[model samples]
Target: MSNSKGRHRKEYHEPKISEIEKLVSSFRSAHGHDKLMDSLRSILGEKPKTLHKAKKEDTKGSAEPKISELEKIFQHFKEIHGEEKLKQSLNEATGRDNQKPHKKDKTKEHNIYVDREIKFKKVKSKDVAKDIINTAKSFYGFVREKLKYKKYRYPAIAISILMGIYLLFNLPLLYMRMNWEKPADTQKLIVKTQETVQKKMADSATLAPGEVVPAESRLIIPKINVNTPIVYANTKDEKVVQDLLHNGVVHYQDTAKPGEVGNSFITGHSSNYWWDTGKYNYVFTLLDKLERGDQAVVYYNNKKFVYTVRDKLVVEGSDMSVLAPTDTPVLSLMTCTPPGTSWKRLVVRFDITDPVFHKPETVTKENVVEVPKEKEKKPGLISRFFSFFMPN
Candidate 1:
């Protein structure tokens, strides 16, 4: 017991690499390698391991790296017998029992995520292509159905017809409203005339050339019964011209004024859309009806100047020859030709035949007392566009 206590225990013994190499060399040099393998087993104290089937570890799986069939079998038997026994078996199979262990490289392991990602992209692309193809097929089928089937067609046709009727019923009334003319306020004209006549009776005098009096600024054309205000604006704009004409005759702003030396130009619509606004728009329509002896009287400064029609001419719309300055005092009454078209211009030339101050008594008393006999409902052009929406 004392010797046993003083003695040391034998440490663990492993087969040396050099000894294994020498064994493998001797096994190779032996005449009969099978007999040598048997000898090695007896000397090494174990039977040679053989692979009859797959090892348990291969079937069981591992937490570490995925191993091959050979490695799994080697590991299972290594736990059972010994490392040397497995090496001998490996040598018998591969003839390299003394070979060095191969180092494992980190890059050799396959990435499952990378493989899945590639597969996912391929599947996603295929799905997108299928969706596109399906959408096109559905659209084509819908168009074909619409063309071949007549189930929804009659309702569509009915809707279109109803819309057409609605537009037709409202459009003409709309056109009439947009283009209706404003009738003159005969009551206001009568009142103004009465006041003017009263003022004129107080200070009637023969007007000198270029002399404009405050009391007299009336333009009377007895032929057409045109008696309205003369609108003068400093602009030659067409819109201004139209606006002025919409109120009354436009005295061309660039031309000579009344009782002046150059031609005093006066223009009014000969004819317009019967619905267009303005009372005196057709004032000049009857202008051409007047004969050479018919008179146009201008009252200025309580003084009167009478002009006699001399000649009338039809000229192209582009003609500015009639607008030239004349040596004599003249009144050029112009209007659009053929009553409605602006293709040509009609000018009725007038000479200041008899310049005279009218006696106050001769001025018509009936005109001042006159009111329009007919009651006209005149909703102006702009008002008509929105008046339907409002309560009357």
Candidate 2:
């Protein structure tokens, strides 16, 4: 019985030598006796095991990691928690209750992707659309009420149309009438007319042989306050006549000379002549306003002939009797009446009371003296031979 018991004890018990040798070798390798004893106890399956001895050995053997490394670990944990909390908040805000909690690695890698995906949701129909529509309707209703009570539609349209018409037609007329007053000084008018006519004729060189007479001439009517330029009527050239008539030039066929004693009859266009700014539109409008004593000047041949506005008559355009030759030296200017109509002509007859003449000398070869030629300078004998004296 004793031998059986001995054999059972031997089979159950661990050999202390092998275990102690292993513990000593481990202590030598780790350079710590306490950690080696703890390791041995753990291998032996000891209850209530503690790592206090191992921790003390570790502290005595090696230095701790740096503060920066410890901080990085702490920050890593904080970022993990913060990201988790943010994801929870985002899911709550977006009403995506069915969203799954992402894995740590995937969450960190695709955080921006998740945010963008969350923003892609369609707006629900129940959110503020009705309020926006109601606000628009309210604004529209307010506008309708204000405009409805004003009752200004018809008056506004009428005023707009009337203003347009006035701007289109009457504005220019009003402007012309305002600026169409006669000057107070009468002598200045005569002087100005004479000077203008003389300059024109001198520039034209009318006395030169074969010189064509200018189709257009200027005239000043001090009585009717007309200072516009006029042109003569040419039988072959209608454009000059048309332009002259359009710009208030009176045409005359009866007088041979500009300041002749025979009856000088002239005709001009009315507003019926198509022009952007028809000069004849107001030609006859002021004719009736002329007085009998007022002076009328005709600019011709660089001279002015002064006449007194003696008689004014509104006659038919075909009145050949009115345009007949008269015994007195008369100046007659006729234009279409009623602005745009040619049914009647306004005839302004005047008697030539004063005549001003200006005679300018002719420019001829006899009067023009020749200038002398310059002598050439030579550098060598050959050049001197080539150079010759020339006559002046």
Candidate 3:
């Protein structure tokens, strides 16, 4: 017990001679050396030098020695006059009436608090990658330890791994949907449409007047950032329409093409298989973000038609009435409901507000339709294999 107490207790010692010299120098610097010398002489029973006499001596180039040399003189006097007397004289000269407070007493009298701030540590990319790998390993180890004695441990781990792989492939879709928004510059789409029209006009000489050029048709929805070509499939055949969707949004056959007195049925994929080779696999993934009063533009032939979204509805996948003709020109955008799933059809309807539709007879020469020549191209083995799976 005594050894433990001795080990725990902190021992204290008086200041050494060198430390006292440093303190004396600091005192002399604070209260001029003349005042320090006068105080020391008064304590030592010697005549103190007058300030006027000291100043006169300094003028004559006979200045006092520095603190270092004065300390040596003090040490010589301490040996002759006695150590305790010199210490008392030094304390009186320095104006220190008592010893320093104990460490415990100082701590109790003054409470010191250090504020530790937490900052976000920026690390190198390689270090960040190493941390991620370490975290993954730790998680794997924890899971393995918890499932070690279970009868269904292997099956549980297999399911967990499969789920992880599925999320790895599908998590991007969730992030894309959450952050989707209309581009700030909506006029750029119109500018792009004008450029496409001007370029197509240059190639119009090859086609007859009033005959539609399918390549010139484009659909621009500012809300969803869609500026894709419109593929006019002149048939209701599901297989033919599905194939055309791979190229762009397919415009249903026998329907009013943009600026006509009927609903222009257009369909696109909300989401497609991850391994699908088509560039438009996720073109309409954010189609459900559109609200009423939004705009959809269609560049048909050389004319531009603008429509306002009036309403939206989800119908059964087998619903055919949405394709029915209307007295006023309307544009219907169809995509699979809930994205990635084909349980229902999300149909967004827009009424033509531009050109001020008067009647069916108002259709100009540009509204004349023509069947587009099907350009045959060979598909790869992967594309052909996936094409037989669904109608998307």
Candidate 4:
């Protein structure tokens, strides 16, 4: 009994959770992102390092590897638990003692995960806590590896960044895709139905003018392919007023409707947060792309009112001239100056050129006049060189 006691006599140290947490907090501040990534590299087997550096280090130094996050964590643990306890854990984890061949098979993994085939040595509760810290450290290392600059060397990180860049560069195309005006099949059907209705109508004047303009009427632009609803906002409520941002195009309730004699003032979001949701959000993002003589169609009360864009005006956000009453039967389409900001407003005035009751059958596509955007002729070398320093 005395000899057995001599062989097995020992007590291990336990670590304090609070102290380690404090250490982690201090480490996070002192090292910041860089240290965090370095620690992670060690945990993930230092993938960023080259074989040459590894061989040089191996030849130059003893068998001792670089200090792992596990060691750093355990160093703190030892201060709380005691040197004896820590040493015992280290010895148990990696023994310098004589080999004792047993029933368990070690894992093929290079990392610390003990293979299922190998049975772990029975350990004290303190050792279990150490294992948890090691696990947490490994997780931290993985995250740092993902975000660090050195991560670019890895296939996964390189591929991911390339993918992200691809997405970033094609943002304009993606925006167009997400906000496509209508479903493919539905849009074709609408055009087809309109053609059928026009063919069935005997006389141009007999075709009914579209329905009465409502609070949530849809405005369609065939050229730019925009189809957005109109939201009416005449109140000063912050929430209600901001609704102009999300609602496709907002119309002043005091303004005239589509078929009225006065100007119909309608505005929609041009530039705002990319993630913003609202049917009208970004409805007018491409409004600036419209050139003079382009067509705009307003659908109200199940009837269509046709207008031709005649002019464009860029003004300060506070400018109220665009909304001022006008005797001419006009439709004003408004949006922000920049596609994603609100520094200024863009107003496009469209005249009611074609009557609402005009049947489509009366017109041919060739006869309909369209003003194409004028292409800017490039200046000669002498002109361009001068223009580089001063506007031409």
Question: Regarding lDDT, does 1 or 4 come out ahead?
Answer: 1
Per-residue lDDT for 273-362 in model 1, tens only?
878767777878887787898888776545566788998999998888888887566888889988888888989988776643233342
Model 1: residue 378 alpha-carbon error in angstroms: 98
For each candidate, what TM-score against the reference? 0.36, 0.33, 0.37, 0.36
User: Compared with the true structure, what per-residue lDDT tens digits does model 3 show for residues 238-324?
Assistant: 998888888999998888978767889999999988888888988889989999999987878776777899999999999899989
Q: What are the lDDT scores of the predictions, listed in order? A: 0.64, 0.54, 0.69, 0.61
How far off is residue 156 in model 4, in Å? 99
Comparing candidate 2 with candidate 3, which one achieves the higher lDDT? 3
Query: What would you estimate as the lDDT of candidate 1?
Result: 0.64
List the lowest-lDDT window of 10 residues for candidate 1: 194-203
Candidate 3: give the clashing pairs. Answer: none
Candidate with top TM-score is: 3
Each prediction's Cα RMSD? 28.9, 34.4, 35.6, 39.9
- How would you encode candidate 4's per-residue C-alpha lDDT over 1-392 as one tens digit per residue? 87754553333234455543444444444434345445535543456342222222223324223335445566555555676765555444333222477643334332344431122343325676676566566665645544554544477677879988987887776555444333222111112122222423211112346634444578889887897786677774646766675756777768888766688988777656657666666678789999998988787655567789899989998888888887566899887888877788899999876564333353323233334344445545545444433532
Candidate 1 accuracy as TM-score: 0.36
**Model 4 scores what on Cα lDDT?**
0.61
Q: How many backbone clashes does candidate 2 have?
A: 0
lDDT comparison, 1 vs 2, better candidate: 1
Candidate 2, 321-358: lDDT as tens digits: 77677645677877777667778888878877664324
